[model samples]
Target chain A: MTEASVRRVESLGASELLALYEQMCLIRRTEQAAHDLFMSGMVKGTTHLAAGHEAIAVGASAALRPDDYVFATYRGHHHAIARGATPEECLAELMSKATGLCRGKGGSMHLTKASTGMLGSYAIVGSHLPMATGAAWSARLRKTEQVAVAFFGDGATNIGAFHEALNLAAVWRLPVLFVCENNFYMEYTPIAEVTAVPNPAADRAAAHGLPGIVIDGNDVAEVHDTVARAAAQARSGDGPTVIEARTYRHFGHSRTDPAKYRPADEVERWMARDPLSVARQRLESLGVSADELQQADAHAAGVVEAAVDAAKNAPEADPAEAFTDVWADGGSTWRT
Target chain B: MADVITYRDAVADGIAREMRRDPSVVCIGEDIGAAGGVFKTTVGLLDEFGPERVRDTPISEQAIVGAAMGAAMTGVRPIAEIMFSDFLACCWDYLANEIPKVRYMTGGQVTVPLVIRTANGGGLGFGAQHSQAVENWAFAVPGLKIAAPSTPADVVGLMAAAVRSDDPVVFFEHKGLFASKGEPAPPDHVLEFGQAGIVREGTDVTVVALASTVATALAAADRLAEKDISAEVIDLRCLIPLDVRTVLTSLERTSRLVVVEENPYQGGWGGTLVSIVADEGFDLLDAPVKRIAGACVPLPFADALEDRVIPTADAIVDQIRTLVAY
Candidate 1:
């Protein structure tokens, strides 16, 4: 979106840039379809959509290796997809299908595919920061070069777990990337009004002895470039980085919210720089044709369509399923 | 025949043996390393295992537990200490919600093989916040294996079992029984999760207890013998994989039961033990089952007041007298 970030976008290959755009499109389509399904009463629980805050997850995910771990929040459709979770599994999970991720037990807020290293999407605010840090510690202890990434919102910075996690990670010099997708609002209220500092995440990074790096989250290239360098730094045994991405959410916090608390101008401002539009512009400026961009968008649309159709056809989560997977042995027995 | 080994020493022995056997096992707490834990349960760990495996973290319960969970998820057997069981409330989200639910929520994609060892029960005169037997908090949550050993051998053996368990275990090491002595645990002794040891078998009445209460119940049984009351004392080693069959079988022989728990009466493990007997072995009961537990209030600070609040040997004997008389 910026002339400076376009320079960063130039680092990515033409095809890699195309893939990032397509990935963002897939997340967008999946969320939009999920929203429709939720309104139609097909989705059982409240769904958190990451429409405007796509590049932060997608760009950051693209920068990491497959073996690296990602700890995401409830608004993590984009992060999950970016970390190799199929749109079908995520949508199927949202619809509570048996074929869904976690077999519909996690519903919307807890979509997890451990095989992909996308550890469960934690619903509690600021809960996963330390978890991701711990995961990084595991990698260090186990002698693996893998890094762990935690995607959270600005609201998490105010919570005690956030500070505790940052302090622990800093002291341990753990290989973790604390990516704060500052969507400007903590559910209904503006984060700035409640938070003490100006930059909630980056401003507090010095206290934890981590480098405070802020980025334009609307620019996928900037997010990818910054995260790539940070991940490399972590992999090389350099400490964790606190990355604050300035972004906004396109929709309400959850299924019921209208997000009328936000100013109309602010919403319009964020909408004007939507991640999808920004990605398209960056692609076109990089000598990509309009027809080529449309094809990628069309492919994304097709993926979402197939995913939604498959999810709808999948059987409902069985009553018996409710009593399964409580233990690692695949049984719900608490007592013998 | 063994020398008197303190219950506190067995805890460290258990962890040290596990750490020796498995390199993946790491211990983390506020003052575990250098300070050797506030209760000295983790003594000699940092010296034996070195600082890499034996770590001391900041006074952040959330950080300690969450980090342990994270490590556990990724093939590390972490033994995290929360100083006091009452402090479990500070990081309860991880214990009650996140840690237990990980395996279930992830559809077994992740296995949380970690142990949370905390100082439990209310006899050290540490007052309400520092001295509550808070295993009841973890008992309500599924996916966690709860272990509260009574003796020195049981402590080492149960600690081995907890560290080695694939399922997350909340091992409640009673603060009150730290100085209490018992037989030394044999080398590499790993206790099973659910086998409730019948420490003292009697046919007149069966009294079930765990942690510090097991000792109190044993003392009560000693006093009850003079009254011609044969009290069978069962030390429930693990609470989650509750050995209900053992409790029910004892009830069948005795035909009367009394659950002695150090946690308050409100949501203690006593309610669960009693319900199992009522539902499955109601015919085994000659009298209404009695629950001799801590009074339903904050554990008072004063020595005498605290004694009144928590079930003492006399209180347990009195409750059984009432149960046996009926």
Candidate 2:
């Protein structure tokens, strides 16, 4: 999908467009810092950065309420930030500090903050699909007008949980939106190389009786509009819908890989359509001043700097926390 | 009031009572509604409560558990049944990941008050595919609570308790105990979690058992008595929230421990019990903790092979003899 074919969902004023650009820039700067820390051995463990895929997170998160639940894959830094988590809390989690969202136990892959309705992010491939469906189902049963959105890669469409969750959501008419960020590659393998089905991952939803849509992922406006419609459909109890966003991950799958599987030319082609630049241009065309855009960029850089400082200063996790949250109070008597 | 009832009836009655007490309580499983469950534990639940409450689902273990997690999170207390414990492997992601971690992941924004009841253990000649005890799998999961009851009274109490819990609980019912008859204690009798029930009290050695092993332990305790050895038998009501205190207390008096379980020896709950005793109560132990677990072999389809794979009273008595002599 080309950027020219992408249609803006909602026309944002100059201020709103600038805010969106700033948010996307903030995600990029924060994740870039993480990549540097990971390279320097300061931050440990595998991190699936959201640097290349900030537009989807920023645009989609803008369409939902804070009370609605959101589930994401391992690549979830942007999702947490866009869902209103402070960059400090998210960075602290990546740094394995005590004040992290999971109290340092979950690290990068399992970071979660239920207070902000970021239900949780899972490292397991398609595991959280059913979980989001269950949460959405719960909301409907309780008469809550909340919706559940699960963000996964194209690779997840082949997993059993994806199919099961979609079918269950359709049969029960549950309030769920399955967003497939078809980033072209499952780690080293491309979706076209792995998936036998010719259509987009969203097309698979039609078999489950839910409407499906394909959109240009690099276009923030398109992602925002498509997800807004899907979220609305879910909140209205119109069952589930699948939105396939054709995007790309510029970096390697994990910290270790440099994405040798993709040709350099393809990566360069995707970099030209960088999501943050597109959002910035949209705002500029709508009469936003160059000074205003620069101010947003500087402020976003400041947020990133503050987050890094806070994460570095955060305390270490107490060894005793290994025993907590296993169950509710009086839930288990296994001694420390 | 005391009444004679089968283990299945006692459990069914517990479900009926809980449904009547809570308007949001519901049941979902295969053949549970119109078919009344394969073993008839829910024989008339659909008739007593409408299909809305006692629901029969398709033969999808993943869906059964996933939907129950969804329903429970929304305020409905769901009692989901997997036809056999062996089938648990198919839907393990839902049980181990989603159901248990939902509340913690949601930061207490929601609660998964769900119960997954499945029959386990061998003796029905159902073979390896249908007759494996998978309670150990549940024991490994963090946020999941596991319980296995031996007597009709404990069955009723524990089933009710499992539903009342806000955490995800995996309740394992022994297939062999379904026909075992016992006196039903009062319907209001509630057996708390992490508390062991001393079925037969003695002082020579403490025999720690759970589920079907309780009966074998009792029989072994009787045999030990004839041999002039007093044996204290304690039934572990809940496995995960294990009654470590009861075991410690029993060992303080009895001075020896023997854990009998239906699962294989390696990575089994019995191993966990032994580790606990060795780690915490080493100074008080008169002898090493002995474990009489199922043979480390795939449960055979043949009756003779299956019998050999499971622990019997003879196996328990033999292990106790070794522990006592030591």
Candidate 3:
């Protein structure tokens, strides 16, 4: 491995490190199970999994306070899991159960838990960035120290909302962290083909007059440390920060995509550096026993399985729920 | 005591009253701060509330509306201005998809108490880019509420209602009506949605209008009276929660309908009103509903051509005469 791939361990305790490992493992196992369920025709609609991008979600979420808000993209199961959404709720949403996060109104692409500060996951690319910035603006106006983190892919950086939100956040000096998960591909097209700049964080941040940092997203510790620092700066009223986390997605853009556009060698190269494995190996090198790591893995697997089983048994949402929640006044005449 | 105030001042007064009543209320838009907005509707707001509440945003409509959505979700009532209704095309996704869908999509986890105020209607000679009325675009969104106030009193009353609504509201202020003077609205007056204002009472033909066309309909009513044909005029204050009851009541009296609007006839809010009347009050109609609307074309810059494209008082009079004869 190159020297850049070797991430230095931070000041986290053994238990904290184990917890991070468990979170990442839980996300992976849950996503894998969700993919299997989709393939078996049990789960309806579509799902965008974050198999390889677990570290960014886990680490960034680990750095945020319980009340800090997180806005994520369609590839957001990991984000929901890391932000304290139980696998049951996440899978229940995918399973279209009434007990789901959005009460099954929002399927896989719109899992949200306001209690955990996991704002709704957006299916439209780069659409939620402004909302995140607006949340930060609200926090500032309310004299609260809450910070909002917007998680999007590399492709979102090219969208107009992305540029507008960044510029507004900077001008208003709102407490927001713009996290870009650079997985190299925006849907099927490679980022290099669409993006005008080499580093999105650097290019976009310069234009908006905000601090930009490109870090190793595969390194959970690095992501945690960088996000922790940025979140601190935001809470202290230093304005927003743009963080470009360089990572990869192990799965296709969606369930049906075989990712035939990607070369076999490139996929193999990234798979070899899987974030979970890298973290596991680092934990082992730090004197963690293999049995302890195995126990964590088993725990994660059990949790995911239990969630799937529970989701399968959860009651279907009432059809009348479609008419509700459309308006606050309870006067929506929309017939189901 | 009611004072004579311009529609622009009425809108500003309504915003100031709301801001004073609620500390969480804020205004964000381009040139709304030190420059007092391109239309000067937001003048003296920066001085009253300071910059923290009155923000001067960059020319970013998507971010402006999106940020307002976020703020509204988090307990702040944001009044964002798009300068011109035509510019809503620039941020259609946020206004159409994100802003309107959030409350419903989140299953009522959040409420977007946002009021997007934009200047609409033609006759200003700003051409297609700045003069086109796009209230129909907002009317099409189910979750969105639309308010188009014609007189100064209605402007303040509707603005208050919009700021106080839990749902997202799109307030279309006609640029032509901004300079027009009317009696000031009562203090703390808040008009409810789906309430129609009867500007003129008649029994020959009922004329439905909104925004700038309300005045035209009234003028046409006066001309129709000279011809011994009295026309009843109804100003539809809000479009989404349409006041069909009032229109139906007028239809029962008049037995004839003529819908007038500044927007094009195809897919216009006037068509929706006509549809409602047709679907519900078909027995009351003495004749088929006639629509007097702008021509289906981009508004041109030239004065004579622009005059032909938009509906005039004469056009409303002619439509009313035809319906009355029928």
Candidate 4:
């Protein structure tokens, strides 16, 4: 927490601050709408909502270029939307329609749009960290100044792949930014209970010879400033940085869990500093009028409503697609 | 012209051939850089391709495979070595759950065009942990393309095809066959998948094998020929794009099938061959289909005990005699 750099909010232009606030509003609206769709029985299975973690995706992605790659976890709607995947397609993927991000093949958990540099949203925990390293290495080999970002939860830091990926990235001096969204809980259990260290990601960054960074994930300006500096270091070939964003998940782990484990006061305390509220206050202090903030919320709501309609109108994916895309030849046949 | 070379040298030649042809081709593994790999299969790769193209990795199988998968998705063709075939279990998640399923999950947005080559099977008393033949482990995964070459020539040929394929390929090179000599594959050699080579053609029994068992089956055929029992040996070059047509055709004339494999009996890859034959060519069988597989037990350390567990040339000969008698 002490090590990460954060500048005052006055440095960001009024237009840029408004854009970041709009992005966070967009994610908040999208995940909430997804929650409604699931409760209405329109979206099946389960959804991992990112209600309070909006600023991390929005602020972090704002610092990355379009060519830079992002590997996010299953609860990655915010990351996908931030990286330019249309809300219509991401919602379509949730509704299992033909027009989805993964064309309905990867429902709820997996959402991939390589065209947008949203490499994928992997459901399996702690798996894609090394993948990000590989992409960064490839960028270096091609002489491109591209960097790769991997977004995971606090639980992933304890996994073997996490250590291996960090060590390899450090040893190779790869342009990788490992962002761990530490929301205090890994599913139902408190991450603090299972984790050996107090700060899972930042505390161990020194072992890999990387900077130990912890930031106020709810503050959009702080997140933006820290990630931008980390990205700059990476692009300049100074190697990776580990950032732990201390936030809280407003919703339960999934659609099924009610998350009754938290004390009422603890929940209330975190909700008081909700990312949307924090960003709104930041906008107000930066001279954004109250009317403009209302207009941003209105814009977010309108886009989500239109996206829902467009996705609902799209037909179900064809059964033939199930057999296709299993191989490069567009066929699953492995034998004669 | 390097007229004759061992199977291990051919492995290096295959990777070098591809690396020379495509700049995107890169090789990485433990001790593969300057030490030339534990089995010396990757010797001369580092000196020839430089440290960038032929790089060494830490003892992290997941990172090696995962990095290769990511590199492939981002346009670099990578070839990762697992050192031993049994060590694939360490990174089974990347191979079974990640690399193979990427294209399908992303709806063809990515192509994991990578090769994972490892030293496979037992003959030199490496014992249980290092000696187990686990190609069957990868064979069960649907999206992977499996290749187990029995000779130096097939090594070069299959390595070319695996590196060029748009899908992920798991290549198994026999540790026992490293020293076996054969004519070197030409520089331009590129064999396709699904084409099984007829090592020795005959008219009695169809003996089908892959990698280590291919040599054992060939030796059995020679002994069977002495006893007036002609055996046709079919070398299945690639497992995923399996040439069952070749096996069915061979069985068409022979009317009897015997599957020889180094994997254990309970869930070996031979079961797939037997099932397909029973389903498609059941009427072509004159006797019950026989499976000469490695004993369902850990490979022992002693030479005699190890010989009992792994399928040997004499074991293949004895089995073929019993099947011929039936």
Candidate 4 versus the native: TM-score?
0.98
lDDT of 2: 0.82
Candidate 1, residues B101-148: lDDT per residue as tens digits?
988887678999999999988877888789898888899988889999
**Model 2 chain B lDDT-worst window of ten:** B102-111
With a 3 Å backbone cut-off (N, CA, C), the pairs that clash in candidate 2 are none
Judging by lDDT, tell me the better candidate of 2 and 4: 4
Model 3 compared with the native: what TM-score?
A: 0.97
TM-score of each: 0.98, 0.92, 0.97, 0.98
Q: What's the candidate order when arranged by decreasing TM-score?
A: 4, 1, 3, 2
- Backbone clashes in each candidate structure, one number apiece? 0, 0, 0, 0
| Tens-digit per-residue lDDT, B213-248, candidate 3 | 999898888888999998899998888778888999
Where does model 2 sit among the CAPRI classes?
acceptable
Ordered list by lDDT, greatest first? 4, 1, 3, 2
Deviating ranges (above 4 Å) for candidate 4 = A1-10
> Model 4, residue B163: what's the lDDT?
96
Candidate 1 lDDT at A242 equals: 92
Interface RMSD of each: 0.9, 3.3, 2.6, 0.9
Model 3 iRMSD vs. native? 2.6
Error of 2 at A329 (Å): 1.9
Instruction: Put down candidate 1 lDDT per residue, A1-336, tens digits, no spaces.
Output: 122332253468778989999999988889899999999999976999998888998898889999999999988888889888899998888888888888878888988879989997999999999899899989999999999999999999999999999999999999999999999899988998999988899889999888888788898988999999989999988989998999988889999688999989988988999988998888888899999999998999999999999999999888798898887778978776
Which lDDT tens digits does candidate 4 get at residues A142-170? 78899999999998998999999999999
